[model samples]
Target chain A: MADAEAKERRILVAVDEGEESMYALSWCLKNLICESSKDTLILLYVKPPRVVYTALDGTGYMFSSDIITTMEKYSNDVAGCVIEKAKTLCRDLQNVKVETKVEHGDPRDVICEMTGKLGADMLVMGSHGYGLIKRAFLGSVSNHCAQNASCPVLIVKRPKSTAGSN
Target chain B: MADAEAKERRILVAVDEGEESMYALSWCLKNLICESSKDTLILLYVKPPRVVYTALDGTGYMFSSDIITTMEKYSNDVAGCVIEKAKTLCRDLQNVKVETKVEHGDPRDVICEMTGKLGADMLVMGSHGYGLIKRAFLGSVSNHCAQNASCPVLIVKRPKSTAGSN
Candidate 1:
């Protein structure tokens, strides 16, 4: 745990296995000042639930094991994409310990929860690489974390070349 | 120039005409600890090229007149959104002015470049909302600003639940 404590001031990227997110992750790894000793590049990806019915129903029997397994598979697929991107981001870095994690639930909550749990000093999120609406783009997850988190939060916007892709 | 110098530390929100971003802009007006006495919220939206064409000789050109018109409409829409959001976000708060800007070209470069030009103390952006990815949602713009800005960048991520949405 103390070893984890040592890397507290490092960068933690919330990735979702996309080229734009990867570009942001790469940008962080390349530009951050982490060479003093060593830092952490914690790559996090979450598996959001496709169906809320089972959760709403609140009964274990409502969902079958097959569905859970399929969800887990989907989670792995997403995580695999994130991990691949992270590896590319870390390809040139030295003295950085890269750790990967895949979780099942809400990404904002999971990421915010992991901030302290992972001993992160600050959080970095890319701006509009994802094609959500401008309103939803800034309001959803980023808004929640900004309002609630105790630590500093970074809300990034991707370039027009990227955001303009629509 | 002196007026611009005195205007440093304004809160710059890259407006993209959305409800979520509007919520974020409003939240910044009310909750920011950076002091409303000397602060203003600068809402900016970058308009992308409407048409991209490769000339016969391989020159890429983006035609403008129509794009400019659309950009005006976009700026008006988001400016209205910011003003409306501010009425409540600030309510009866004192000493803060809310301003909006319409721009053409890259959003990331504009934010970073403006940060330099405005001598901004901080830049804020939303994390994830209506972006392309379902689970991983930090926009690339949020990421780039986090890494490249001279000043601090705040990336806001919101919660998905109705109870947590506010």
Candidate 2:
């Protein structure tokens, strides 16, 4: 722990096109970033892998190269948009270097790998607050990362306004 | 989020005899507690429920009243010692209100209930870092709290120096 205090900490935050992620980034900025410490905040947006459609696999849907290029472009634009929104949340950060990254892969795998590859001291993400059945069906990204990440993981759960709300 | 910024935050930290928990408290003190914000740090220790042995056609294990009393006293002492150690860790905290609580129940249930009952904005605890088989045998308290606690949960995982180290 003494050594932990002396070195610069790389805090990797996984972001996405969801309000939950933005809320997490905002919470991180407000709570974790110390004014005196040298902290690097890495905002990572993992794009879902592109669909590979073979000629024999499709029933009715056919994709031309132009359409595929358009879809890839849209994915890139979404990643850029999400990163921009996350950056806006960190506008007031002081003594913290903010960096952004966009990677193409499954989020759970990529996030856990990046934490180890980049020597992250901490990983921050948001909980979707899904119900038991929904979480079982969709599989929680934050939960997976919390279990698998090499570094400490901080899960920022957004408070639900009402019991009936998601 | 603006309202959250304006109000004081209640952070509940669960501690035990394990070094993992103390590491979590230290990490929370270093990373989460802001100098300028009004934060209430609640240190909670949960004692396991006393074993109730019924006189049935079972194994030959009996507990005398004196033994039960001594066991209860030991439990009390451990709780006090752990809480005191956690308090010493927070001795240097400024602009933060520190409170201690000792409750009798399972750690997972007691910790989650306390967070909601105390209106905690966040819950901090340590990960045991159990492997799959060990975790199956002994359920993870941090994982349970992370799923059930109403507030955000920050699990501090102590870094293992060697790959073979636990």
Candidate 3:
């Protein structure tokens, strides 16, 4: 039992375009990943659901399919870019397997669901460090995941000293 | 810079008499601590503040100093026992420095303050898995520390399957 417990672990890390998540990935690499273990690092990026706008909602113009396609392409491009950046950060990892996953949904729900569906031993994500009012308004993904995730959740908050410098 | 980043880290773990905290400590030991790094694990146990009683409106009876002294001694003994149990869990750890500290106060404030004072790189604790109503009434210590701690917070939740079996 001890050997199985200390063997391979699947660590799911939620990443996004924000520097905070990138910092979390870096932090996990530095602090959590052990050189002797065969750890699988799953980098998950959740894209916001596509908005369906209708002409009846006071907008005088009808949206074209071309425009919707362009917006979706932009979202995909952003996801690809973020995943590429995250992959670059993992270039130096040894004895670890890195996988990338991109999904579309509310980040809070998607991240939590993915943690369970993926059978992750642990979930690592970054905290936005939003103040009370802002967090109430915008809703914190990390907080929601921390409460709902089945596995242990690691919420990495970037220090204030390096928040702006990075 | 890379060497410095991969060097020693101070990890502060808040523990108590509950089984949940022992699970978190064991989880941290299995997943977070690396054999090659010089990680210092600080085990902190916070004893709830003693309640003060007054005869002005409560039970119309005055409490004796002996009772208060006995209560204080019991609290100290509980703290000592908890720390001793935590240390036992770390007995197999190698290349890791384990330190124990006991403080008296509300756990939320003490754990957060100690993380800052101790300059911890990460703060780990267990989630009580309280329901919405219970959490609203009891005020979760892990949730508060996750919000207020200066460092990253890892909230470990025991799997429901093994929660009762242990």
Best DockQ among the predictions, by candidate number: 3
**Model 3: clashing residue pairs?**
none
List where candidate 3 sits over 4 angstroms from the true fold.
Answer: A1-6, A51-67, A129-138, B1-6, B51-64, B129-138
| lDDT tens readout by residue for model 2, B65-135 | 88778878987998899999999999988778999999986677778899999998888887862233333
Off by over 4 Å in 2: A1-9, A34-38, A51-70, A129-138, A162-166, B1-8, B34-38, B51-67, B129-138, B162-166
A best-first ranking of the candidates according to their lDDT comes to 3, 2, 1
**How accurately is candidate 2 docked according to DockQ?**
0.30
lDDT of 2: 0.76
CAPRI rating of model 2: acceptable
Best by TM-score: 3
The alpha-carbon deviation from the true structure for residue B92 of candidate 1, after best TM-score superposition, in angstroms, is: 38
Q: Positional deviation of A60 in candidate 3, in angstroms?
A: 11
lDDT of 1 at B63: 44
lDDT of 1 by residue, A1-166 (tens): 1122133355677776445566567545533423433566778776664454255445556667887787668767757876786777577656667778777666667777888688765566654323243224234565455555544476554554564563
Sorted on TM-score, best first, the list reads: 3, 2, 1
Per-residue lDDT over B1-166 for candidate 3, one digit per residue giving the tens place of the 0 to 100 score? 1353258999999988888889999999887776556789999998775542232226766668897787788878988998999999999887789999998776778888999999999999888622333334448888778778999999998888987986
